[model samples]
Target: MEATKSADVVVVCAGLVEMAEVEGVDRDTLSLTPGHDELIKRVAAAHKKVAVVLSNGAPVSMPWLADVSAVLEGYLGGQAGAGGLADLLTGKVTPSGKLAETFPLSLEDTSAKPYPGGPLVVEYRESLYVGYRYYDTAKIDVLFPFGYGLSYTKFEYRDLSLKQTGDKVTVSFKVKNSGAVAGKEIAQVYVRDVESTWFRPEKELKGFAKVDLQPGEEKEVSVELGTRAFAYYDTGSKDWVVEAGEFEILVGASSQDIRLKASHKLAGQGIVSAADKAKLASYYNVTPTTEFTLSAFEALLGRPVPANIQPGKGQFTMNTPLSDMTDSFMGRQMNKVMQNEIAKMIKGREDTPTGLTMRTMAKEMPLRSIAMGGGSLNLSKLKAILLMINGHTFQGIKALLGKK
Candidate 1:
């Protein structure tokens, strides 16, 4: 390895400082600096095989992506890294990392609108056209798209299938590692409306699955599309109106690489009537789901109930809160079940009380315990009240919590 400034993941890897210069600048409006071009050339010459790793907080014009033999993103891989990079580089670890942002061929294919902070207060002028949503909607070609990544080993994606089970839609496929080396593969699922009444993206990522495969081994990727996944945030309707229509499902390595695809019409029908859309729009600027925070609580309880459920005609109760039906026996039982599950999660947080005690015994705790005080107390409480029923102040608990 060369003597260079290390970033979170092999930081400042000979060329990062040059790349960082255009961080906040608009890719389309901006041009590459001469110094950056020189730095790129110099870095390419430093290594035996020039593999460009594109990592940034947001998208950048990768006119240079095709120029390099390979590109990997270490997007926001903070602090402790390099070991992972070294492993992937030396073939010790296969590059299983997938992209978190879309890389545009040029900034033009990107969202046409720029951030609103130009000589005025910053505002979101682009509205919904963010990330791949913008590029796909505008039909702009991207350099590299969201969910795009490559591995040393080659994988073949095949056998696309779609089926409707009640309101749920299932898209299943097979991915085989045809290359010599064992590796990991990500199966990407994208959905596009065939007869959308309003303007929509060409395709949107519905789901993704990651799997490990030995050389020549094949694995199945099954993605289920719920009502929510297919629905778009209708600004006018003020709801996620799943308008009745045919939709195309695309499965592939990246957005552009469509290995297999299929189309199906939605079962039953959900019509967002003009009256409903108008009434909803008057109450709020857009549909309720647009501003609602998706809750993990739905997944927390054994049953699926909205943590932060969205408001719509049939999606949820109109006047009654989903969690407020506890007066009824079924509702009370559900509440109890949710409470028990939440308790389990809280208790799980204190799993290593004995380890904290050991650290305290060694008196090696750092001084920033103030930041961690409550956590240590919770652990101690769990060990005493829940684990042993011996509610004594465990030594080193204070130190572990930054109290020392």
Candidate 2:
């Protein structure tokens, strides 16, 4: 292959294999070893620029950081990894790689909790906070925190704007790739709520955008902020509540390395209670949900009972005792007619049993007549239909007719 032949030197970043020196070494002077240093040493001895292409299946322990000139974390590279690495090695493709997983200085400093030996009842003692949140909040040091990635070229971020438009907030910024090589940069957006009782990380990653740039090219990126993003999970209320206060929007390369930062407040109605029925009531119109329920049935008339309803059970009858003909006409007649038609349709079919259809029959049936009648069913009409259906006297048929 021309790729392998053209490269002056090839350094593969085969990640950390053995954390401890197995049976050969004792416990006292046990020092963890990095995996990439040997490859770097080999390539450096041969006098090459050194593409330390890091490839790993899972997170590896990078004990040594300063040895390698360039580091690329290639975890579980897909079908294109081999060829992609070859191109990057030969300088055919600019290395747009970055650290996917944070490289901790030591295993002890890592936020990774010790796994239980056996599969007993293991609890997530870490609670809601994990990864960089754990390290950032606990003040623990990490080799590289979350959202840490690298590009072939260097980038500079400037002009961060966090402005409120009505209820929502918009964040915008400019990124210019300053390095000579072309690369793809990821602009990470994080939010920090200063005043909150709940346990929270120093900052939380909210949104991200991947940007590609030619050498020295710059572009502006904008992101919109929704209310849910800025709020905290309140244990007392059992909901995400945005407390009335100032929230900071941090734009950066990683969770810890913030490049540009700005703050904004949630204006308008202030803090809305999760249990506030009045707030929820504001979302609906003058017509109650009963109107929507009725509209669904109104549209179902003359259509197929839609396989959802049972043939005989698709009717609605008067709920109360009917005092006069007017009550019977509206309540009983409407229910009986619809049921009679559905029953006929069910009897016509042989293979599909009527029993399975009965459970959901009423719900699935075309209840347009009842839905259009514009009010709740009276009690009399309900009893009459139940009595007829229970009595096994097809007299419930009258309820569906004589209305319109």
Candidate 1: count of backbone clashes, pairs at least 3 residues apart or interchain: 9
Cα deviation in Å at residue 7, candidate 1?
A: 23
Model 1: how far residue 94 lies from native, Å: 0.8
Model 2: lowest-lDDT 10 consecutive positions = 283-292
Question: What TM-score would every model get versus the actual structure?
Answer: 0.58, 0.56
Q: Which stretches of candidate 1 lie over 4 Å from their true place?
A: 1-36, 43-48, 53-55, 62-67, 112-115, 118-123, 268-404
- Residue 244, candidate 1: C-alpha displacement in angstroms: 1.3
Q: Residue by residue across 85-194, what tens digits does model 1's lDDT show?
A: 76776789888877777777765444543332422123343445578776665566677777788888999988899888987988999999999999998888989888
lDDT of 2 by residue, 1-404 (tens): 23434666556556433322222122222132332455456555554445566554545454434545566666657788888777866678775544555555566654333432111133333443456766676666777778887655799999999777766778899999999988888888999876543335678888888888999999999888888877766544566677677678999899888999887765322343444323223222211111222222222221222233212332433322121112234435544555565566667552332422431343233333244445554434444445454442355445533222
